[model samples]
Target: MTPRPYLDITPTQLATLAPGTRLIDVREPDEFTGPLGHLPGAELVPLGTLEATLGGWARQAPLLLICRSGGRSEQAARMLARSGFRHLYNLAGGMLAVRATPVAQPQG
Candidate 1:
């Protein structure tokens, strides 16, 4: 089977994602919830273990990967693409940009 390609998403664009979207933060645990904080529902799936955990992840849902400054997440996205993950996205500029963007609050 051919591998799928991943996309690059800016923080502003990330804010547009639907609530509850599966955001995979590929940073170390502390970094995920540390000084940078993290996306509201983003799960901590560090790059090192990402490949092993992919088997159990649902393929249909879009996966958004993030890290300190996008490098790690970019690698993670490529890894997922190689594994045939059809819908993958890397958070461009990572949390730094995410921190600068105004978060889109869920509409009531």
Candidate 2:
């Protein structure tokens, strides 16, 4: 087994995600669109079903995982890293931090 790589990123750092960056929210559906709105272009892939749903995703694509708190997303990042997916990052402080800062808008 290889070492797990963990990368922590912030909202300000993500102000300009490079093209093809997959910003994913590992929170539940309700939480995604609830009081704490999700990132501009974050895809809803709740952690519970993430493994099963990731079967066809591009393993090499840049992925930014997020959750209500940083814990769950960190878990997801580790999982992907173990599965041979690199370019993984967890949103530092998660949505709670996002709520405190203006987030990046989706790029065209």
Candidate 3:
């Protein structure tokens, strides 16, 4: 079998995600609610239970994986790819990077 394919999305790029994009955070629920506040529509799936939640996510929309640091999310992406999911994206540096990123503001 061939290696599964996936994509990466940087923190800066994440700030610009289109409306309704599904951001699945594979981190623990506590981490998700703590500092590094999540994006508007991000959902907490947690790495341990991601497999069970995959089916419910909207496959047609862009699926972005996230975690505390990125390792778990990477694993999630691999699993999702093997399950025939397309448009899979792993947050490049996870919440650390996301927190470091500066959200752009609209200019009047």
**Candidates by TM-score, descending order:** 2, 1, 3
lDDT of each: 0.85, 0.89, 0.81
Query: Candidate 2 regions off by >4 Å?
Result: 1-4, 102-108
Best by lDDT: 2
lDDT of 3 at 57: 63
User: What TM-score does structure 3 among the candidates reach?
Assistant: 0.82
Clashing pairs in 3: none
Sort order, lDDT high to low? 2, 1, 3
Q: Which candidate comes out best when scored by TM-score?
A: 2
| Model 1 residue-pair collision total | 0
What tens digits encode model 2's per-residue C-alpha lDDT throughout 1-108? Answer: 965586898877885667889998999999999998998888999998999999998888999999987999999999898887889989989999888887468999
Candidate 1 lDDT over 34-89, as tens digits, reads 99999888899989999889998777778899898989998998888778777888
How far residue 75's Cα lies from its native spot in candidate 1, in Å, is: 0.4
Candidate 1 Cα misplacement greater than 4 A, ranges? 1-4, 18-20, 102-108
- List RMSD in Å for every model shown: 4.0, 4.3, 2.6
